[model samples]
Target: MSAVHEVAPVVDAAHAEPYATRDEYAGAIGRIRSAAEAYYAGADLVMDDAAYDALLARVAATESAQPGWAASDSPTTTVAAGIAGGDVEHSTPMLSLDNVFDGDELASWAARLERVLGRPANGYTVEPKIDGMAVAARYVDGRLSQVATRGDGRAGEDVTVNARLVAGLPAELARPVTVEVRGEVFMTDADFERANELRTGHGGTAFANPRSAAAGTLRAQDRAYDAPLSFFAYAVHDLPGGEGLFHSAAMAAIADLGVATTAGPMAAITEPGVTATTTPTAATTDPEATTTSSPPAGMPLCATIDDVLAAIESLGAARGSLGFDIDGAVVKADDPADRDRAGFSSRAPRWAVAYKFPADTRTSRLVGIEVQVGRTGVITPVAVLEPVQVGGVVVTSATLHNFDDLVRRDVRVGDAVFVRRAGDVIPEITGALLDARPDGATAFMPPQVCPRCGGEIDRSQKRWRCVRGRACGAEESLAYFAARDSMDIEGLGDKVIAGLVRAGLVTDPADLYDLDAESLAQLERLGRTSAAKLVATIQGSKTQPLSRVLTGLGVRMTGRSMSRRLARHFGTMPALQAATVDDLQRVDGVGPERAATIAAELAELAPVIAKLTARGLTMSEPELPTRPAAPGSAEALEAPRLPLQREDGSPMTVVVTGSVPGLSRTEGNEAVERLGGKSSGSVSKRTDLVVVGDGAGSKATKAEELGIPCMPAEEFATLLAQLTAVRLG
Candidate 1:
């Protein structure tokens, strides 16, 4: 394990001094807790689990050591409350079930239940424990009333607005009686898969697990349960007197009322440790009302819990075949009368506990990282980690995600990154112990050139990508050339591109025009039949339509939709190439800046087209996309060039070098855009200005070499303020 390796401390706050005052200690606890709650809601975990535990321990020790320093928020006196942002006022407090790790622990817990209730449980209703948020939903009369989370034990977030969006929480109850049903708010296996897929599609990070997935979704501001988050009722609370319903019967009632639930209490009969009461205080009030007179003499058989647990275990064994996810089995006492007798604790009822199954864990080393450019032009850096055993399976490399992550984590070339797997899935990084850093470790730097095209790289408000965009002469060109909106070259995929590239027969798009049968025969996998077929395919690219040719050129911001609009706007390649930005803006859908980009692109590619013509490449200029004639004007005139302007209408191209306190390298570009200026990715003689922050080495020196005006980030900000004032005045 990487944990065993010894090295320097990573973010080591371990030896740091403790809080000097009690109030500070208490305040720290609240601060840490708030951070944890917000972070768990949507963002990444800021502090590791162990770090949090250590903080909690520190708070407890401080509160005990100095009684005068004790405050209301002290960890010693108060528990970390559940998230309070939810508006859900549950029908009853959503209580937490006791947790047990092993079989022996489960049995020992069951034994304790028997002692408290004075008899064996009659039967148990075993169901697959849903790995999700616990929720309690209430229906007043015939309609949905309130829904809340299992917040710190007593209070939870009021997520009624969001809860009402969930599929299982019906607006109108089937039975028409006042009912409060409890269930797990979860994302289904399919739903979890789809959500992650959508996240991947949107160039966002994938969620870790279904439980976290469900929780994160609900915690988002301005989002509702209208998404496909699923729910299944497991327990219920109903009754004016709060004394009549049995544990099994209430669950059965929940099922009958249109809430999907497990078949509870198939066989069972120990009296339970608690009962349902609809009153606000019934949850806390009734539990402490009953008490045992004396300790049990022998191994007391459960009266309510025994049967309930037995049934629960049987259901657990059948969970996998039934098609769902489960982490453990729940065992609660059945006898309503005995449950009231055993009373309550601060967090959970005395009768119930979850018996969990063991998960496997193993460790591996990280060896290397590889960069992958996604479909949306976002470049993600994936680690080619050292192969290792985890969760009883062999695991190799995991993801480092992106360049920003690479810089933030400070993961180096040779450091050992911990990989962990669970539930038979690919391994992922759980920890990076810098103490385990190896000698000669080098920081990973993102490539300034495109890994695929060897073209200049640039960053935008969204992500970093090849500056060449679709114009980059690379494998992406092959894909674009073969796509439906382009040349419609069928059967040319990545494998075909690979075969051609490796054969030393295809580098530029023009190389495809020079392929021969003799060169094809030398390929490892290619036969004479296939060779001729590929050669024939290359020759047919000449007959492609004008729209296809335009899209196939891989123009930036010109996808199928944009291509169609541009095709209709100019109607011909010559017209498009000659049309100025002003003429472009005159077209229906093309904005002024978009027209400028199009004009610039046309001018840029004119040489490329000339080269193809000189080489005798087919030039099938079609009458398609012909522009409409304007009175006393020429439609084919060249567009004039103008300087790019910032958001505040100032002409500027600010180049940022090094790191800024208020912005990331990427965010600085946005800041420039917000100030009404353009952000140039590179520094050259023509560059208007450069913002140099800390670590200004290569780019700053380059700016000096180019004789471009430069300013520190602070100075740049001051300059921007001056510019803003000038514009405003």
Candidate 2:
């Protein structure tokens, strides 16, 4: 056995308190067991570490008060399993691979393996360990009969019901065969978003990543609710009654059975071979040069330690085209018979090892937190960090996740944080090193103002948002309205919007319908043509369909998703506006919170719509974003709308005044351009819109002073919707 882990107590609260008895000690032990289960199972922690320690201390006092009751299994007697734990299960026992940090350690392990087998080894298999949920599925007579999650090596939860739901799992076999398979259940990029959208709307918490979501879902008592999640099988134990079902054969069988098992690993393999020499080669003759030779072909490929590194490099270039995520390559032995000669240690197999490339890391200082109000009013708290170079890109900000995380990690302004841009280039703060902490750091408390609207904020489920939703938050509300499914205002540029706000003209979505060139000409960058194009686009949006109008409202708890459901259900703007909480509750996916939010938002906007309608804004169901044309109907499948704007490719057309989010003036402009748009420095009929991130000085009141639409940071999405449809042609 290895040396016992050292334990050092940090704090002592219970030591100064009362109650030194055996019964109290038992109760404390029970609490730790329960808390440990939740933490390891990937569930929320019910108690903090301090509280857990206190309990242990209390138990210790009890044991001291009455030593006879301190049994071997007593809480005070066992080691405290530090926080960090669980996954479902492997088809077969997924034993942990032994790790060796250095070449010498690896060499030691190999030496031990050879001793057990009494000879040299020839072949082995090495694969990158996927960081995800693991499960084992058993097929009986070519039909899936049982599925279980990895619990502890020996036993696991029976998740057969949920496993069967994943589309990849075949209900019946293609050939008459019984198979046991192992794989990961994951949510794709789209499913992850859809699930989180619904979760936010329903007042439920979201999982951290696909792995966490899949793991928790497998353990769910109510498997039917989240059946939409996806799964992909990788390992299989189906051969000549388990004879042909080794590593390579298992993958092929999984593919034949219709499960998209992991592809590419089995191909171009070069397991290492080890043979002891009778004597060392004479150094005087340069023996190293005698044994080494050039690679076989286009790229270098080697099988022995003599040529293994070259083979890995060639295979890495091919991974991108292989359709899987590979962090490194594993090298085992090619001959199974020879592998027996290598044997194994109590921890690791002697024949295989992993060689990984260097990971990308960057240093950044946590500057501040920026609260952004989205269309659904679920405010996302983004972290504003000092610009730092990571993977050759300058990242100025990262996600702090949510309120709970901020408190848990104790991340504060001025602290140095490590940032990582994952596979999709999404910037996130993974962890921090407290040893590197400097002085004068303080915790951040979310602002009470609507950062853009100067409105009071409301907090729910640990998220804070402006009560007015889009009504107060301009840029966000505007972009939401201008979204493809919303107003489809094509030509409005974000620069034009900022120009209007800075020059004092465009205010509210209503103001877009009232622009003229004479006033726009006065704005900083506007001349004759830009003003005319802006006015023309504004006039054109008057004929947008009713579904688009409904979406343009920037309703709380509503986005492209809720809007579609509402539009399809009501079929018209007036009907949807008239929907009550009781009415919206009947929709397939609308929960109570969503229904209430929708009803409240529509009720508040009744007057605004009445004005637009009276002015002859064309309001009818546009067939652009329809679900599928059912048996007797002709509709598009969740019809894809040419989004008035996208956050990724172009920037939102907007002007800013009074406090905006922390985005600097130039950066704010860049943010708009990347989303497929530009920014306007002033507010005018010819100008598109205005955005206010933070500290919006006199410019904000002036836009209001000019009766122009002034948007706060969050409403950028709504404004972009209208601008996307606002075009010169």
The model with the greatest lDDT is: 1
Query: Which model scores highest in TM-score?
Result: 2
lDDT of 2 by residue, 1-729 (tens): 000001123235324243466666566677766655553364433443334545555666666777777756554333223222234444445432343323454456556655666754443344443334556778788777887765544356787776665645566656667777676655543444455555544555554343444556666775335524554554556454445334445555556665544342222211111111111111111100111111111212233442444344433433322222233455555454544455554323456654432222345678787876664445666889888654336788887656655655566777666565433344666444454456877777766677766777776655566687554556555665665556766656576666665555655677667678777767767788877876787778888656557667766555443455566567777877777889998764565666786787678777777778876786665442323334223332233323323323222345655443545454455345423343444443233456665677655654554455656676654544454455322
Q: What TM-score quantifies how close candidate 1 is to the native fold?
A: 0.42
Question: Taking the tens digit of each residue's C-alpha lDDT, what string does model 1 give over 1-729?
Answer: 001121212221223345777667867677566645643353433343223434544665666667677665443333333343344444455555555644566678767766876776544444556656777777788677877776654556767776666655566666577877787777654565556656545555555445556777765566322334666677777644345677767665665565555452211111111121110000001110111111111111233443344444433433322223455666666667757776766546776676653322223456777887643244657777656544335567765645654565566677655444434333445335465567888888788878876776776632466776544445666676667556656556777777777666675556666777678768767788877887787678766545556666665545543554465556666677777788877754455545675676677667655654454544443332123234223432332212224223333767888887666664566456445344665554346888899989877876775567787788766655565465568
- Give each model's whole-structure lDDT: 0.55, 0.52
The segments of candidate 2 whose C-alpha lies over 4 angstroms from its true place after superposition are 1-129, 132-241, 246-380, 386-394, 402-404, 414-426, 448-454, 479-507, 514-534, 547-552, 555-570, 578-604, 623-729
Q: What CA RMSD would you report for each candidate?
A: 26.0, 19.9
Please list the residue runs of candidate 1 whose C-alpha ends up more than 4 Å from where it truly belongs after superposition.
1-42, 46-91, 197-205, 223-226, 239-243, 264-325, 359-729
